[model samples]
Target: MTAPAPAIPATGPTPRPPDTGARRKVGAGLLDPRQLLRALPGALRKLNPVTLARNPVMFVTEIGAALTTGLAVADPSVFGWLITGWLWLTVVFANLAEAVAESRGRAQADSLRRTRRQTTARRLTGWEPGAEPSAYLEQDVAAAELRRGDLVAVAAGELVPGDGDVIEGVAAVDESAITGESAPVIRESGGDRSAVTGGTRVLSDRVVVRITQEPGESFLDRMIALVEGAGRQKTPNELALNLLLVMMTFVFLVAVVTLQPMAVFSRDFMAAAHDTAALNADGVRGIVLVSLLVCLIPTTIGGLLSAIGIAGMDRLVQRNVLAMSGRAVEAAGDVNTLLLDKTGTITYGNRQAAGLLPVGGTDTRDLARAALLASLADETPEGRSIAAYTRREHGAGDGEPGRDVARPGMTWLPFTATTRMSGADLPGGLRLRKGAASAVAAWAVQNGGTVPAGFDYAVTEVSASGGTPLAVARQDGDGPAQVLGVVHLKDVVKPGLRERFGELRRMGIRTVMITGDNPVTAKAIAEEAGVDDFLAEATPEDKLALIRKEQAGGHLVAMTGDGTNDAPALAQADVGVAMNTGTSAAKEAGNMVDLDSDPTKIIEIVEIGKQLLITRGALTAFSIANDIAKYFAILPAMFGAVYPSLRAANVMGLHSPASAILSAVVFNAVIIVVLIPLALRGVRYRPSSADALLTRNLWIYGVGGLVLPFLAIKCIDVALVQFVPGI
Candidate 1:
């Protein structure tokens, strides 16, 4: 009787840590009142002309404010003072938006710095020829003193000293300080998960780490610098938008400058035609012209542009994604095709032996024994599961599984991409192998074995059902090699992927699965996971070629990968998100790092990226629309008394020219403060088509921008008429 299939034996390189980090909810704190207050002084400091000049529109506004303040001081009218005060407030409010964003970044940097506090490392000085932990000589040293190639031994409860690879031993590491994860992850000496970040704590066991980077060059150091905003430069889109704003400011500047002559001419004409008092009207005043100029330019968007970019990066940090540059974040927004690696991304990664099926009436016991001997020395998850499956289904006989199975003097062969198989040369010149069905069949034929009639059918049956078929074969001394049977390795598709991919589909992104599995298995998994397409039996070169091909077709690609072999393709993709558990090479190659190591995080990143662009675009539309409304408020007021017919264009009747112009200036300044929360929090982005998003933003921000300012300025005018006496 069978021994109950034995629970499938716990297998794999290492047990993946539960992703507790992604589930942790973080509050949005960029708009906290305390943060706003803390940012106020920085805003005041930014009043320096040199600092303010970076934004052309805002710089022009400051110049206008300075001009009005001086004129107000010289004349001292109630109307002049109010306009000047509001003008100055406009510049200050603009500076405040940027200050708040940078302040949050600096605060995040401070938190990271606390985690990176210097710790003592037990640096290895020497290692003896043994494999035991006690064979090494170690010395205590500061973490900063550790350099590349230096070896350090870390024990339980101690923080990892520097970014490094585990060269020996295995342990559970808590990366909560960096990844915001509370669970401990297994970091072993071999495989892609060998990389460990500095400042994370070791939870259990001990590992000998080889530092990969010098001081101030580790991943955490880079992350700290990024969050500090010291390395932030405007993205290409931001630069292009700034150029557009500068041109718009220039156009408005020219319109404002020439308005003086027009005002003088209108004053002269009105005085000659009707009354002499028209010559002395406030319309010709330079301060009045300056107020109009300030309100006409696109100050609203110019003020919040930097804030939008900084907050976008800050949002990414909050989501446990560290983008190396603003460009990568922006590119993520435009990804047309997402090339996902099938193993870790689309599926649960590890393939396990589900069963063994014998062909051509072969005895099940004979096939089980051959499979066990072939997989005994294999370290892959499938190999270990196979041996465990055999021991439970068959029997250990006189010895334990994987221990003293047959005889001595055996030579082991490990799996490689080229060979596509792993096996051993047993005692008495018997060779046993287990690997890809095609690979083993070819080897058996090469070794003069007669092909089993039902071999092809068994392999196809397993593969068509989304199972990898590993064929077992044997060659006895001086005799023909014969096929034993096929081992079924089952792959499980990750949960909720179909729904997530459907969301991406709605967002106009195509999801492609790339894997080394056979075509049948690839098709089955791809359909089950709901990917748009699949490329089976792909090599590393095939992945790179596919990225290039997609780019050639004018598609922007985003891909996630963790293996060192995935580095080149990751580098080639437009947005490459490397898992934090990936190798250092893969991490360095990719543009962004997912601290939570969730492949589906690219979906959130795409949303954040799109939101960044949407926020800037929506605000820009509102700002321009705002300027259009201001033209109606201030233009007709400036020229109304000089030309009576101009009063007809003043849609909102005002008590005086003073009230109308001042109301426009006040509305302009107050609106910047009004939208500060929106600028920091960003506009809500749902996955939809480009045209749909455009139409919605146009109706909301664009149409609303035009209508709201008219009512707001009119109300401010009515309030001004109640109190002020100058008019």
Candidate 2:
């Protein structure tokens, strides 16, 4: 190849010791006690009808608190004042639930912004490979003020100021601030790894970046906005739940308002049979009316609904995976098939020359010499690995096999998918080729060379064992070529892949492997990894076609990719998780990008998505179920004095009208505090079928929600009347 570019000194900026990997993403989740304490005042302040009106359930409580306050002030009684104060606490508790959820996203945004601070950029008038320190002027600018198309040189340990494409040089970038993984990944000019995010830190070498986006318009900025809820809109499920809550509120309002007249009718009907002589005033009926509406209207879920959605997106950010929308996170929960590539994703991707096998009269050293010459200028990973192997194993230097090593006017033929081979042509009319075994064998036989009887056997043996066989050939002038030998390229399957795929299968996701390798190699890898299926010799077009076919059948497909060829498929898939170590195009195309570059991280993502939905569904069941117990505790207490027959329905045996109402309200408020940890941490997930998970959650939240409240209300009422020395 052309002479290697001169190496430059890495003296631009020194990285902080701890900043090499992702800075620790430590922050308060919604459940932290300190976070709760900080949010209490804002939650309490939002208890007014103006702040609470959007939530129909909490707004009813506000109205009840206002009316009760007036009654407590006008005609003071221990029960009237006590009921009024508890009604106020009811509104505050609902506000606290939402505040805690918003806090998580805000905390993540703060952490991201810290990594995006303004740094000195070496401003360049024009980029040149050999530009010196004097050719570029160092200038300081705020990261937010950076404009698109600005060319800046970023050295080792410097933060990238804007999202851009690397126009020159190569370096490793630490992207942990955005993707929670701590590893520093290589970014170079040309090919897929050229794009650089604005907030990531450069760890080594210097790159001249051509800014592709303005300061606030970068991917990281948009992600920060998403986390902070600046673009917050209710999710589809949340909107549906809201509509349902409004309908439920309307039904409860009609039932509660008309019940007063029904209670009056009950009073007259039971006037002779019950203790109607002792009961007086409709004030108790009014207070109990508001309490029943607040409890029946799904208040617990409505209060924490927005927080649940925000926390899901926030959880993704904390894990170093950024989702373009909250909906994508939800879709991940429903992914049915996972299409992953064999290289880099399933295997380590470092295909190496394990051994060289000479054929016919060819010597082992001669085979290695041919491999080294063929791969001398080759840039592909497989080529570089072969060159290194020849140097280490055969003691070959940086030249052709024999003496007079440097050949004049030698040209390298790069390997292409169409040609299926690469080699060097020397000025002395010497030709060397190495690539797929089949292509090399055909060329040798075409040039009148006799093939060894074991040639086919050698190729078959290598393919069967999963080792890629690259056959080497040589030619002199216009004469026939001779087949030299075969290079055994061994690619390692990543450790623990089989177990992870098993976990995905347990989660009801079918894992499929797609690769450019032959069917024999693909089959070997598929068996070792335990994937449900595999597609061999898969081109980029094949990848796109498979995604479309799966989507046609209504399967939610998720895949990890790192190449520009993968962009279309990633865009087409339901849940496209691009590896951060992949190209910028892949990152931009996919809905989510994994910072850690771990393919199995999709499992964690799927778990987080499922947990979010489960948390919402469980709390909803709990909220509606709680209304059942509220009616039992308060309805009879409201009309029990006038209609003694209704008193039997008071299974709580509450000591007073105020105590029963107060106890139900107390349980409603405290339950929000009790489930805060569950809301933030999310419900635990079990790898069972959808039907089984639904059945289990329903029992925990549905039946338990109904049963637990009745017992809790009774206990609170007993404690209040017996220990507090009040009515």
| Model 1 lDDT-worst window of ten | 1-10
User: Which pairs of residues clash in candidate 1, taking residues 3 or more apart in a chain or in different chains?
Assistant: none
Indicate the TM-score of model 2: 0.79
TM-score of each: 0.79, 0.79
Q: What is the lDDT for 517 in model 2?
A: 85
Give me the candidate number with maximum TM-score. Answer: 1
Q: Scored by Cα lDDT, where does model 1 land?
A: 0.83
Cα lDDT for residue 167, model 2?
A: 81
lDDT (10s digit) by residue, model 1, range 1-727: 1111122342333345433223322224447888778999999999999999888889999998888778777666666777789989999999999999889888888888889877999998776434555776789999999999999989999999999998888999999889888988999887889999999999999888999999999998899888877778899999999999899889989987866567465555445324223224353266777887888788899999999898889899988899999999899888899998888777778887778899867898888888887876676777887877777767632352343333456666766778888887867898999988889999999999877998889888987899988999999988999998999988767677787788678879999999898888899999998999999999989999999999999999999988889999999999999999988888999999999999877877887888888988999999988887778888777766566688788888865666778888989999998898889888878777888989999999999998998888889889877776544
Candidate 2, residue 2: how far the Cα is off, in Å: 18
